[model samples]
Target: MASTLKAVGRNVLFGLLMAAAFPIALAAQPSHPSQKVTVLKVNNGQEVLVEINGEGRAVRLACIQAPLEQQQPWANQARTALSNALPQGSVVEMELRARDVYGRVVARLLKEKIDIASPLISRGHVFAYDGYLGRCDDLNYPRLERQAQRSKAGLWAVEGGVSRPWDLIEASGRQTQP
Candidate 1:
């Protein structure tokens, strides 16, 4: 009986060691952020509704948070802006930050050398998602964002200026008027 108990203990230790190895190996792998995805939809800002390959999953645009559909001056405009940014055959490079509760890829998207997320913020089409603002890591987004706001660029052109994407998501699903 004692010998059997000792064997079980050894197996548990081996199992724990094996489990630990997987994550470390995965982490060691380079962050191949970009994926071959098609633009399925584009909300205001850089929030693109995309269809990812491999899993063929539809996910919200990663990184910066764009205004919701109804909140924009023209709900369609929100989509149009993103559509213009990422046209058909556009392949985005996404640095997978994490997966939200819904399993969507929350990432910092890129197009060539341009950091896609920053442009959305600086362009005033989207805001730094307050939930994970993270100091606007790559770009000096705040300064550019200010310029966009002052100029009333894109979504900022609305009446009261702009509203946070999170606020729009949180508020009743009503569109904001200019």
Candidate 2:
């Protein structure tokens, strides 16, 4: 019985070691590779349409959801803010991740090596999106969001400022029903 228990313990330890090593290996593999593209338009704070290799592709900002244009206090601001940061005809680098349900390639846009999401999230223009893939570690997002909330920056300045787009969509769905 002692020998059997020892074998089991060894197996468990091996399994734990493999589990811990998996993510580090995956991180080394680079889930999203950087690609240069021309910015056709900033769809919103969290989405942009770009021309890559002469093809137009919609890229949603990974790990964030900006308010829609109708969300009052945030919608229009989000769009305008993104537009200002990435103007038309601007060339930028995109770290492309997997696609969403809408077929847009989720990515992190970088202009002059500066991450575009930083300004949006830090200023309270968007939220630290929790719906993205868990394995993709976006460091400093939670910290930036907390600072924005504490400072009452951008949309956070208004009462009930941090309303998510998904929640607003759901609320509108309920309102329109018979």
Candidate 3:
């Protein structure tokens, strides 16, 4: 019993040491570490799972709303278009913004010197999400969204128009509420 207790204490100490060392190690890494990632798969219109130097992480495009799957009219199309735009295996420079509730990194990606979100937005594959406007300081965001709305691009071409994902989610919540 004494030997077991000693072993357990050593294990706890080791765990604490590792836990404390982790942040120090992470902080030692370069600020704004060059995040070169390869798109492994499109999780949704607004998110992708990427591999950066063999580490995988979820990256949610900042300041954008892609249709939820059931939102239809263009949910799959949005994902497909985004996938085509950020072809699998293509390397991109990800500018980190913040992390979402789902623990996904929020970032704007650049591919071939072009903002990855631009074509997607201009083509109406996604909406300029205004919920977290403070983090979305992109000036072209609203203009591109408006252009898509006016030009009847992508889902905007659907009859009665496409619903924003956040709105759809809110509506769903209301419906489900007592």
Best by TM-score: 2
Per-residue accuracy of model 2 over 1-178 as CA lDDT, tens digit each = 9999999999999999999999999877655678899999887678889998899998888887787666776878888889999999999999876777778888888899898888898998888775576524755677888899999999899886766777877877754200
Candidate 2 residues lying further than 4 Å off, grouped into runs, are: 1-31, 171-178
* Candidate 1 deviant stretches above 4 angstroms: 1-46, 49-53, 133-136, 168-178
Candidate 3 lDDT by residue in tens digits, 68-172: 878775778788888888888999999887777667888888898688888888898888875553577544788898898899998788877787777777867
Question: lDDT tens string, model 1, 1-178?
Answer: 9999999999999999999999999887655455656665554454556666544454555445655555646445555666777886677776666566666666666677576656666667676553452423444556667788888877787788766756765566754321
User: How much RMSD separates candidate 1 from the native structure?
Assistant: 10.6
Arrange candidates, best TM-score first.
2, 3, 1
Clashes of each: 3, 0, 0
**Cα lDDT computed for each candidate against the true fold:** 0.62, 0.81, 0.81
Clashing pairs in 3: none
1 or 2: which has the higher TM-score? 2
Candidate 1 overall lDDT versus native:
0.62
**Cand. 3 TM to true fold:** 0.74
Give the lDDT ranking, best first: 2, 3, 1
* Residue 105 lDDT (model 1): 63
Better of 2 and 3 by TM-score: 2
